[model samples]
Target: MKIGLYFGTFNPIHIGHLIIANHMVEYSDLDQIWMVVTPHNPLKKKDTLLDDYQRLYLVNLATEEYPKIKPSDVEFKLPQPNYTVNTLAYLQDKFRQHDFSLIMGEDNLKSLHKWKNYEVILQNHDIYIYPRVSPEIENLELKNHSKIHIIDAPIVEISSTFIRENIKSKKNIQPLLPCKVWEYIDHNNFYRK
Candidate 1:
């Protein structure tokens, strides 16, 4: 099984996220795309983030209908501030029968070197970079590497932070989120100030 791991905080899984994951399966060589819900991203600030399980639940709700996409809580059991190299290593070890690829945005390519054992990550797994409105990959070190596959997936300009702000201000986020996810947020009263 060839799987693409699309890791994110997923504060509330939105349609844009589903769009990218679905596109990965349809356009890329991977058989499945797993939305790896990160408990804590080493590079990001954790303040104001939703509980890991709630975020995971939202992701599950948003992705449940997509046969090609699935939600993963793999990072929940791992140590805090999980490193990509370690998570990838763990996944590779447990799923020996499956080939794993890292799914990321074009913007991440520029900061690859800042990641822990980033070189090892590149050496072991292929990286599928979906396009973002941000500037192109400026990191020339690995620009031409065969392991880096840059793909033009459909871009969604909206972000989770924007959705959270809108919710806090009592604005409707139906257009930004999947119906089920919006319903879940409504039921749970998430992201309110």
Candidate 2:
């Protein structure tokens, strides 16, 4: 099976995420999309994030109805400060029958060189890039690599940060989130200071 791993904090899983994952699975050659929930990202601030399980739960809630998309907690079992390369190595070992690829935005591609052992990731797995509203230029060599595929997915502008900020401000951000996720956040009073 060919799986595209879509890694994110998923502070709260929203519609934009679903749209991208669905698009990738249906529009591309990938058989499934795994929404990998990171326990801790080296580049992001841990203090601002909700509990890891809470975010994972939201991902579950958001993805339950989509058969092609599923939530993954693979990063939780591994050490903290998760790196894509390590997770990929573990998954490759465990699921020897599956061919794993990366699902990322154009912005992330621009900064791929900074990731730990990024060259290994590029060499072993194919990377599926989705469109993002990023102005930064990507490394030409990396962008044009045979293993890198720039998918013509929709340019989703919605972000978890935007959703969180609106929720904190008591704005009606229900449309931005999955119905179940929005309901859970409202009941639990998440992101509301």
Whole-model lDDT per candidate:
0.87, 0.91
Query: Tens digits of per-residue lDDT for model 1 on 35-143?
Result: 9998855568777688888898899889889988999999888887788898998999999999999999878888898999988999999999888877556545676
Best by TM-score: 2
Which runs in model 2 stand beyond 4 Å of their true positions?
Answer: 41-45, 135-139
Q: Could you give the C-alpha RMSD of every candidate to the true structure, in order shown?
A: 2.0, 1.8
RMSD of 2: 1.8
lDDT of 1 at 19: 88
* Candidate 2 local lDDT, residue 134: 70
lDDT of 1 at 5: 97
The per-prediction tally of clashing pairs is: 0, 0
TM-score of each: 0.93, 0.94
TM-score of 1: 0.93
TM-score of 2: 0.94
